[model samples]
Target: MRAVPRPAILGSIAAVLFLACVAPEDRGTDATNLRDPWAIRAEPGDPALAAGKEIFASCASCHLADAGGRSDGTIPRLAGQRAEILEWRLRGLQDGSIDLPVMTPFARALTEAEIRQVSAYLASLPRPERIGSASGGVNERGAKLYHDRCRSCHSAEADAVAASNAPRLCGQHEAYLLRRLEDMASGNAGGAGAARAVDPAMEAIAIALSMEDRLRVSRYLARSECD
Candidate 1:
């Protein structure tokens, strides 16, 4: 067996200790005090957009300059995501409802206005023409699964309102989708310190699907084109 490097072990220990020291209540921003994210928009040439671009620099390290995320699906693409959704998730991370370790600290550092600015900046970016995928081949079974189970909420129509705040799944990374499905099925979708309740309907759907079916669906969604 390969021995772990001392520096790597020490770094991991430091990270764990840091997270442990930060109490959920003490972490950061108040979600309730935030303004309506949907109401905020940063158009091109706006000062807010410029500020947002600066703020987004911190995020680019993980999400990438193009916000395309990693092909391995460790991260989710931020480009072309709805500002409303982005703000919502950021608020969730800030308030300890979402609980992503890497994101929580960053989200907590931002003020409500900063969140709006960054969300708008990311939304302004174009969606990736080529999204990350785990496999090259399309799964026909996955297509059927998506059409039957997911199409209603994750509509392909440009004018369609997201049902139940369901995000655009098409063009997402397959591994990320699969991981989320597995987490939802196992009642572990949210990380530690998650105060907000998980959606019962989505959880139920995830639990109902077999592992193979989840993979199929994820693969299908990854290959799909966004309008």
Candidate 2:
């Protein structure tokens, strides 16, 4: 497994598990919107922001200076993300529900203002340009996989929206894609209450994936537009 970042590493695992059982309604982000994530409140050369920048140095390791997520998706992209969303997730990582080994220390050291600063810093960064499948090649395979196994409810691109509680797979991270699949396949994860799209007996969907194919499909999905 990859090294967890600071204390927040465990938060990733916890988030998934919590998300598995969390009602969709409860998952709402704390921030209003992220269209201009940094505009909530701040001034150029704000002193608190400067302090937040110093504190945010640690977060940069996994989140990247741009606040974009890990290429493998171990961490979700933070740039342009909703402020409340970022705060909520950070709080989740710090308090429990989210399991991040590294973030523990990080969170412990932070003050509310620091958190806001970091959130602002992340929001201020430019959003990444997401990418996805090359062409018909990967999509063909993904399509086959979707219909034969995933299509009962998750319609095309795993985007059934209201029909199912499952998350949209269109612009998800490829690395995260692989990890979630593995977790589901292992039966260690649970989201059935939220995802009627997955058939009761469909646990084998993970087993159906070959190592190579799984990687390929995930990469394709990750590259798609998330905006």
- lDDT per prediction? 0.61, 0.50
Tell me the deviation in Å of residue 168 in model 1: 1.8
Cα lDDT of candidate 2 equals 0.50
**How accurate locally is residue 146 in candidate 2, as Cα lDDT from 0 to 100?**
56
lDDT of 2 by residue, 118-210 (tens): 666654555666542232334557656655766554445543223223344555566666766665566644333223222334446666787
Q: Candidate 1 residues 32-93, lDDT tens each?
A: 55344344486679999898787767556667788776677567766776676666566666
Clash pairs of candidate 1? none
Candidate 1's TM-score reads 0.73
Which residue ranges in model 1 land beyond 4 Å of their true spot? Answer: 1-40, 94-106, 156-163, 193-197
Top-scoring candidate (lDDT)? 1
Q: Give stretches of model 2 more than 4 Å off.
A: 1-21, 24-51, 72-76, 99-105, 129-172, 187-217
